[model samples]
Structure formats: C-alpha cells, structure tokens
Target: MMNDESLICEETANFTLGNTFYRSQSKITRDLGVLAAKIYKSEQGRLRVLDAMTGCGVRSIRYYLESDADFIWSNDSNPENKAVIEYNLGFILQKNKGKITYKNANNIFFECFNNKDYYDFVDVDAFGSPNPYLSTVLWATKINGLIYVTCTDGRTGTGHLPENCLQNYGSYGRSHPAAQEQVLRLIIGSSLQEAATMGLGIEPIFAYFSGSTYRVMLRLLPKINLSLDNYGFLGYCHHCGEYTTISYKQLGKVNCYHQQENKYYNYTISGAMWLGNLHNKEYLKTMKNLAISLKWSTVSDLLSIMIHESNFPPYFYTLGEIGRRGKLDIPKRSQLIEALENDGFQATNTHINSQAIKTNASLKQCIEISEKLINNSKVGKIND
Candidate 1:
C-alpha cells in the first residue's frame, strides 16, 4: 500500500502532503499568490497572512518562507488533516511564528472582525462558490489589504445554472464564447458589491482563469467605487459573434446593433459584472519585473499577455468563431493581432484562451482583417 505522506517541492518550499487534496496543476496559482504576497511585504514592511482553507498548509508555508510573512493564521474546517498540516508546518508552530486552527472560515473572519484583528493578505481558496466569504472576508481584511478569492464551480459561473448564478453572484450568467472571462468578472463584481455595502471599494490586481478555475486578486480600498461605468452587463450577438457593454439605463435597448430592421438576431446578456480592466497595468508590470528577477520565465510570459489584454473589452472572440463567421480557415492568433495593430486597432492575445484574441475592434473588422491577411500572403503570413 502507498504511504499517506508524500514529499512535494514547489518553488522555494518543500512540504509533505498526506491525504490532503493537492493539485500539482495549481502550482502556477500558488506562484502568483506568493509573488503578490512578497510584493505586499516589500511595500508594507510586514506580511501577515490568513489562509482560510489551509488544506495541507502548503499556502501557509509558502507565505511564511517564500513571501517572508511575519505571521500566518492557517485554518481549515476539516480536522482530519490537522496532523498533516501540523507536521508540514512544525517549525513555524514550534517557533510561535503562526497558529494552526480548526474552524469554519466564516467563524474565523467573524472572530477577527470582533477583535479588530485584520490581516494584510487574506486568501480564501474556497473549492466552490466564494459567495459565503465575499462579504465576511472584508471584515477581516485590513484597509488596502489584498484579498485573493477562488471559484472552482465553473458551471454556475458559465451559465450552465443560470438560476444558481443569480442566487450566488447577483448577476445573470449566459453561456457564450467568453464565459470564462464572464465568471472572473462575476467574482470581482460580486465582491465589489459586498464591499460597497460596507462603504468600501476594491480594485482588481489580476483576474486569472486556469482553464477550469477562476481566481481574482483584489485590493480592498477604503472608499466607495461602485459606479455604472465599471459594473454592468455584457451583451453578445450570436449571429454576428460580437460583444457590447450595456449599462442599467440601456437595459430596455438591449439588442444587437448589427441587426437590421427586418433581420432576426439572438442576443445573450450576462452581467451586472465588472466592466473595468481585468488587471492593473502598473501592478502587473511590477509583478512581471519581480517574476523576471526571480527567473520565473513562465510567469513573466503570462503576465505579459495579461498586461496587454488588461484594458480590452470585457469579452474576446476565438479564432474559430472568426473563421466560422467569415467562412475562411482559422487565422493565426499572432498574425491577427498584427493585422489589427497595423490597422490602428488595439488587439492582443487573451490569457484565458490560447486561440482567442481580446481587442477593441469589432467582429466584422476582425473578419475583414483576417480575410485580407489570408489573401495578402506577402503581408499577412510574413508576420506569422
């Protein structure tokens, strides 16, 4: 029989996982979190972390060792994993550098709020919906602190369960080409709504989708920033493969602008979600610099894409969609981006999908651009 404990090494930390759920693929997420924590520590001159779902305590260990966190509160609701967590985090426990607790995440937040004890970094790597912690987490987060939230329930966020979407995020989710991005916005917008209720605000440092998981890192602000310009609906036209934003006042006029008076078109609207930039450009640049200094090439590359697409429209069009609508073979993502930029349009590859491009150019413009690129082989394929 295989032993319960297995040695695992990630980045600068070495730990043992014992029957606790550990996803090797999620290492990139952990890397980003650690980098953010390290940056916070450097700026604030101290790092205090509250990891709500410690699992095997890998996050807590990384915060302490890699981020140079001065103190950590690692809590998990399941007591079965206590021994494994303690074993992996024995040094910190013995040194009184942190504490290990078995408590519900909400209870911990409540306790912190009651005691006015807030953390500089609060990470709730929840398995499913983050609704339960969306509001409560703010209670334990210091003003200007960072809150990293996770949502693993893709179905609900992607409109598979529209009913559940309304209940969970206070927004309507509709399945579309940009559903992954939709979910990320939902998480941010929902958190903003919760924060705004308490006269607070938040700015997204980054929103990442790892194929199946959605994670957003937000910086809690001390003032209110809920506005129509930054929170609204996303409208997608099924017929034209186009996207547009709709404000509350535009609800009654929600129709595909591409539709002719006599033509019928299908439109899918998803929101009351975040309509602002998916990432902070300067912050991402800072993270990219740190990643480069640390010799983390993959992270640097990902951040490059994110920085480019940070201020793009809320949705993206896949190469396949462009090709199918234009009745042409799929064009290379890189070439399409080049074509758009040559035409004075903002275009870049989205980190959400490898074959997708997020740009301010309309879908028709993209199709025409793609067609021109395919025909003008001398100009188009060269960029390839």
Candidate 2:
C-alpha cells in the first residue's frame, strides 16, 4: 500500500526526519556532534561539513540549523534516499548552503580530494568497522579540521573476533573486563595510524561510547604524532586483574609481577593501540561550557565525567571484577570510589562503564580498599 508518494516524518532536535532511515537512540550522538561542530565553527570562524553517511539527512540538517554550518555536503550511497534527503534538507539546498549526492562514501571522499574541496568537519557514521573510511576521509578533511568517526562493530573491536580486529583496527584485540573502553582506544589508535601514513597527526578532541557504539572525534594535524609513548599496547594480567602500558620495545618483556611462588605470569597483551589521553580536558571544558549555556544539563553531566576520567589509565576495573577477584560481594560503586579517593588514590566514575572505576590505584589496592570499607560498615552496624 506504501509508495514513493507516501510521506513519513519524524522529529529530532530541531530537524524533521523525512522518510529516511532514522534511529531515535542516536540523538545523543547527534547532539554531541552539533555541539562540537558549533564550537569548531566559533573557533575557526567558519564551518563547512561533509556528512559522509547522511542517512535521512538529519545530521546535515542539524549541522546547518544548529551549528550554523556555512556549507554542507551530504552523501548517501542509496539513490532511493535522495528524495528523502532532499526533502529533509530542502531549505538549505535552495539557499545554496548545501548539496546532496548519492554516491559511495569512498567515492565522495575521493571526489573531494580530487577537486581540492576539503571540509572543516567530516562525519562518517559508519556501520561495523570505520576502517574503510579512516584513511580516505582524511583526504577530504582540512588540516586541523575535525573528523567524527564512528564504529558499531562491537564484536570486532571488543576482541570477540581477533581476525576481524586485526583486519579492521590493524591491532590485536582481546576480551577483558574493560573491552568496551578498549574499543574506543582501538578506534583512536587506528585513526592515528592511518593519519601517520599521510605524514599527519591527530589530537583527540574527545572519545565517546554510547553503550554499543564507539565514537572518537579527532583533529587532523599537519605533522605526524605517532610515537612509542602514545601509540602502544596494553597488558592486562589475567591472573591479577591489573593493567599496564607496553611500548613496542617492551613487547617481549611483558611479565606480570603477580608471581605465584616462583612462577611469573604473562599478561594478555592487546594493542598497538592508543595509550594517550582519551579527551582533551581543555576542549571538553569548553564543550561543557557550551552545553551549560544551552541549558543541556544531561550533556554537561556526561562531559564532566569524561573530563574526570580523561587523565586516568586507558582501562577501568568493573566493580564485578573487583568483587570476583577479592572473593567478596560486589562493593557499592559509590562507596568504593569514596574509599579510594579518601585513601589518596585518584578514582572516579568512567562514563564508558557505569559499574566501573578509573583510577591510578591498582586492582589489588582497590580490592583491599573495598574489604576495609565493607568491614568498617559491619563494625559500625554492630556498634549501632
């Protein structure tokens, strides 16, 4: 009964999703993207964007309406979506503010490069691995421009598929308690590696995980930023539940200190991934201020957590892991964080995992602290 004449409309933020593929759950990411784009525009004095996977053209509409993008090029491979995209972005198209194209994403990127039409911002909302566009998108991105790349392939990135991880991220992935966080780091590291191939570097503007999806916004630099310290591996001890950074030179030396009698343990090393700060604190602070000005309380709160956990290690320990390792009941996340903080260990909640904590303290230290807190609670109850 449905035909091309049938009109379908949905609303998100300030735009209408016109008969195109739309996911309501992805609105938060679009919101964050709009905020980041607005901030980029304010600082650079102009904003031209290339939405490589425009879908229903919602993002293009938001970029134009919310971020005040000077120009936007929205592309989707499905020619059938052209009418919907145009319908959604009609106003912008009529005003010469944007263009719509039906072409493969890589073809679009190649075209941009061939025509020397670089964008100040490029958003690639890729399904599964973002590896395909990781290197190609840079060709369309201006130096110091922002690239918002996304990956929904949790299985591959989380180490459930080692072969796929290597093929996609160019790194080994291993399943661990903190594998979700590892997905974010893998994307950043892979992006860095791709950029380095072009004699360019990237700085992490922000790294975000929205439950199942992993996203990282990076600023392309004119120089290469790949080095031993920042581009490295992570060694997680299966025996003791500890995490440590491993450089390229230290690959053969990855031995866990958690020795049993005379037996030294080997760590499950996962990397050739990013070991750098996940978010730029100053930039996140600026984003938070913008969120505050807009009265977006939820966004502000999330940004606050991201800023706090930015300086911690690349991995986090879930309360479940701490409990299992200690042979005790799962400690309350809030109480554990409080105890860790009081004991001079910098511990905070990670937005990546609600039940986890990012801290400078070791897993053993965390377990010990949890025991003391639980015991103290018992003693207080007895006295009462």
Candidate 3:
C-alpha cells in the first residue's frame, strides 16, 4: 500500500502504522473536533488547539482540514515520527503557514501552564487511562476552555477489576447494563474530583462510549460553588434490577430496598460521581446543527439519539433484561418507549445500548408497564 493517501489515513498491509495510527475510531474524534471548532469559532472566533498525544497526527490533520481552528499543535513523545506528521499536514501547512506545529509531549503542559500559556482546547487521547494528564490539563485549560480525554482501559472503567478502577478513578464501579453509564460517570467524576482539588471545576458537555472506550469532552471553569455536589454515588439494586443515583448528601438516607421489601432485595453502592446529566442538551443541539452542516456519515444519527436522551437522567433500563426478571416475553424497545409515553412517562432512547431505553419513569412504573406490555404481547401472539 502507498505511504500517503488523501485526507483519510489507510493502514498498510504489513501493519506498520503500529504506535502511530492506532485509534481506528478516528471519525468520532474528528467529528467532535470539527463540531467543537465550528461552535467555538461562531461563539468566540478562531481557536488554538493542542493534541497532547498526537499519534501520527491523524486527528490534527483532520482539525486543520475540517475545522476552523487558527492554530494546531500536534505533540507526541516519539519525535521520530515528525516526518509522518509533517507529511500528513502538508495540505494545510502550505497555505496556512505556521498554523500547525509538531513537538514532543514531554513536560508540554508544565511549560505552557507555567508560562501562563493556554489553549482554547486541549485533547488527552492517550492509549491507556487519561487520568495521568488530568492534573496538567486542569491548569493549562483557559476559562471555558474545552478538554477532551479518552480512556480505553475498559477493564477498570467497566468494573471488571475493581481494584484498578478504585485506584485510578477513586470510586467503586458496578458492572451492569444499567450501570454502564456509570463507567462514563466514573471517568468524568475522576476528572471533576481531580479538578476540585486544584480549586477548579470541570463541566462535562459531551460524553459517549463505543468499542469499550469512553470519550468525554468537558469545559474548565473557575470554582465558586463547585463542591462535591457534582460528584456522588450510585446505588444498584440487584433484586429489582433497578439503580438509583444519589448525591453524597443523601448518603445518610440511602437504602437499597427500603421502599419495597422483597425476598430478593439486595443493593450495591457504586461511587462519588457526577450523577447529573452526562450530556448537555443545549450543546448537543448546537452539535446537531453543526454536524448537519458538516455532513458526517453516522454523526447525525448518533447525535439524534444523544439529543433525545440528553434531557433524561443517567441510568437506563433494558426491556429484555427487565423482561427476563419479570419472567415474561420480551417487549419491543419501540413498544416499550411508546407505552411509557402513553402512560405519561417521558421515555427516550439511550445511545449507550441499542436494547436499552432511558426515561423519567420510576422503577415501579417501568416494572408495571413491562408486565402490561408482555401481557398484551402474549394475548396477541396467542391469538395469532
């Protein structure tokens, strides 16, 4: 295969682009960067962005070609790939001279923040957990600046290894479909908690999970009343298969099955996290509009799902899982959503899982609807 292609980076048959072009899910990152730049330019004009871990500069190249960013700094530890980065950005570097710079990622944040240098955006897309870079970015990010971080360590994020999850994220993580959103919360909570220690506050504007990895983009702002209110624990009831998100203040009053006593009632608590909205509806609206203009392949579809679920709370319940627990036939996701809506419960589709649905309906109401839907399905199927 050829060494260079158009804007797209194609892998060679020999798999030579090992450490460099690894993030195959580049489109999501690119689309987000483009949308961010588009929105930033409209709101505050051009922006300066930093790709803290630029692997072969694929993301940086996209930023230059697809975004309205004024300057892009692609930094990485491997200086040997300087030529590769230069070649990738050749198209934009020619006309927009001095617009893109490549350098080592070594002590980059310290140098910038020490000199009071800040960027409109800073991305920490490291291979493993992005926790290590949080301290630095919190200081380097300008007020209202955006910071995008990705954690591919699904083992820890998903609670497969509780010890590592606790070590890196400082929270107990529970493994479940409904609690999958907690993995994203665990990551966001860590970033927010880390920022809080430094007298700064982090506001998560966008977050999504794909292929066992979680990508989140947040805004850095000053700490005024930014307490642990944004950070709290989540309670998952094993008996009813329902989870509740509660703040730290409510910890004293938290009980797994106090509302209803059942033989199978059991509860597990999961963290001091941001139980609030994982996404921002207003910003998501802006992203949808901006994404429409950009014409990405699957972004509009993804954004539509996120927009619908943006207004709802964090946890989601799966109809199939709930059906199995109720010992009833599974109801269609669409049917469940419609049933909830008809019952005056605001139901929405969750992008986290296709079989899952998010709604403002209480667990009891949701359980009631599931039984009703299954009963209706059984009658229809029996008649058929």
Q: Lowest summed-lDDT stretch of 10 residues in model 3?
A: 10-19
RMSD in angstroms, all models? 2.6, 2.2, 3.4
lDDT (CA) for every model shown? 0.92, 0.89, 0.74
Off by over 4 Å in 2: 1-19
True-structure Cα RMSD, model 2 = 2.2
Clash number for each model: 0, 0, 3
Clashes of 1: 0
lDDT value for model 2:
0.89
Better of 2 and 3 by lDDT: 2
Between the candidate structures 1 and 2, which one is better when assessed by lDDT? 1
- In model 2, the Cα lDDT at residue 243 comes to 90
lDDT of 3 by residue, 327-376 (tens): 77777889888999999989988888888889988666777898998788
Q: Stretches of candidate 1 above 4 Å error?
A: 1-5, 259-266, 378-384
Model 2 lDDT per residue over 239-339, tens place = 88899999999989778874456667898989889999999999899989998998888889999999999988999999999999999877889899999
Task: Indicate which candidate wins on lDDT.
Answer: 1
